[model samples]
Target: MTALLLIDIQSGLQETVYYGTERSNPQAEENCHKILEVFRNKDLPVFHVMHNSTNPASPLYPGKKGNAFHPLVQPIDEEPIFQKTVNSAFIGTNLEIAMISRNITHLVIVGLTIEHCISTSVRMAANLGFHVTLISDATAAFDKIGYDGIRYSAEVIHQTELANLKDEFAQIQDTVTFLTELDN
Candidate 1:
């Protein structure tokens, strides 16, 4: 079975990490919505991986209002949701068990903060021998200041992250291309 693992597509992350409310890439939310729609239409299992932080003020902290999934990528009634505190979803969560139970072999990855959580999950998925296809257009990150004290735009950071993962940890593809083939 093919499963779509949406990592950290939370409201707080979207607003903070991906600049969801900003004037940049206005189509980002639309792209995410299209991804969700296509995945749902295929009857694929949609797994929502949320990062839960211990800090109450952190966006991902459990029970915090911002801990909720992003509205654009909200789960359907039958979809499964998993909360993880660690960077890798398989580490502190039942993701592997659930995948094994479902006989899932191919994982379609999407969502926020490409440099950290998303990157870790993709690498781990590849290490665990799962065929991972990352929808490049569907995943995004925010501008980050470098250790060298250089500031990078969200797209620049996202491109570097994608470059590191593509053809190594995952096969990066456009969301529309993936959905088109699957829809056919």
Candidate 2:
């Protein structure tokens, strides 16, 4: 069966000031909500992955308001929530075991910062033999600075990361196309 995996779509990641970076895709959360609606309507399995940063000064620190899940993609009762301090959700969590227990073979992944936790989780999911579909429009990325002091725009970083993951780790699709496919 297919399952929806939402990674690190927490309030902390929504603030660009916390990361000292600008983010692209202002409508990413909206798109994620749409995708989430489809998953719920279809009665598919849904899993939420939260990042709890170990850094004391980080916005994602435990007990902080920023550590809470975004309202748009908040989990309802019975939906499994996995917490991790690392980028890959499966590393310190029981995500893989949960998927196995439910016989979930396909994963539709969405959430924050395309080049970070999203990228890591997608790669690991594919390597573990699950079919992954990454919704491009349902994810966003923050601008990054290179070691040589070059700054890359969030749009460029987002697109580049998607390109890297395309066809290799996951099948990249936009929210519209994925919803359309689900409709039919």
Candidate 3:
């Protein structure tokens, strides 16, 4: 069966001040909701990966409201929620064992900050033999600074990271393509 893997789509990412910069794809959460609706309507398997940052001062600290899942994509009781401190959902979590146990072979991935958890999870999913379809429009990225003090725009960071993951780690699809496939 195919599963929807939502990585770190938490309230903290909505706080621009917390990230120290604006994020690309302001509509990302909306797109994620749309895809999530499709998955629910089809009764597909869904997994929510929550990032509980180990940094005490980070917005995503376990007790903070920022660590909570965004309301729009919140999981229903039947959906499983996995918590992890690392970038990959599989690391430090039972996600891989759960997927293997359930015989889930294909994954539809979406979430915040493409350069971080999203990138790591996609690569690991592919390496673990799951067919991954990453919804580009449903994922966003924050601006980044290089070691030399050069700044990269959120769009550049988002696109470059997607480029890096394409073909090797995942098959990139936009929200529209993903929805269309679901409909058919």
Candidate 4:
């Protein structure tokens, strides 16, 4: 089965933690919606991965409004959501078991923090031998400090991830191609 992994589209993370310059995706919400629409139209499984922040005050922390699923990325009644603390979605989660049970192979991933959760999960998925397709435009990130001690722009981090990730763990594709392929 082909599944869409909507990784960490939580309100707290976007609105509270990574606000301002970080939420600067050209069409942030819409990009996610487009990906969601493709999965919905294709009648494919959409798995939502949410990060459970340990702090109650943290956006990703439990009991916080920001820790909840963002309104724009709301799931249908039948969809499944996995709450996790680790950057890798498969860790301590039933995600792998669920996918295995369903015989799911191809995974379409989209969501926040391309430099973190998305990157980690994609690599993990690839290492586990899952065919992964990362939505370049659908995933967003924030300006972050790199190992080089330099502040990197969101686009810079995103592009770097894309460039380095290709053929390493998963194949990176543009959102337009993902959507276009859905039309066929």
Candidate 4 wrongly placed segments (more than 4 Å): 16-26, 147-149
The residue-level lDDT of candidate 1 at 88 comes to 88
Q: Against the correct fold, how does model 4 do in TM-score?
A: 0.91
In candidate 2, stretches whose alpha carbon ends up further than 4 angstroms from where it belongs are none
Q: Give per-residue CA lDDT, model 3, range 114-180, as digits (tens).
A: 9999999999999999999999999999998899999998999999999999999999999998798
Q: How do the predictions measure up, each by TM-score?
A: 0.89, 0.98, 0.98, 0.91
What TM-score would candidate 3 get against the native?
A: 0.98
- Tens-place lDDT per residue, model 4, 58-143, is 67778878788878889888999898988989998999999988899989888877878999999999988899998888877777
Question: Candidates 2 and 4: which is better by TM-score?
Answer: 2
| Residue 127 Cα positional deviation in candidate 2, in Å, after optimal superposition | 0.4
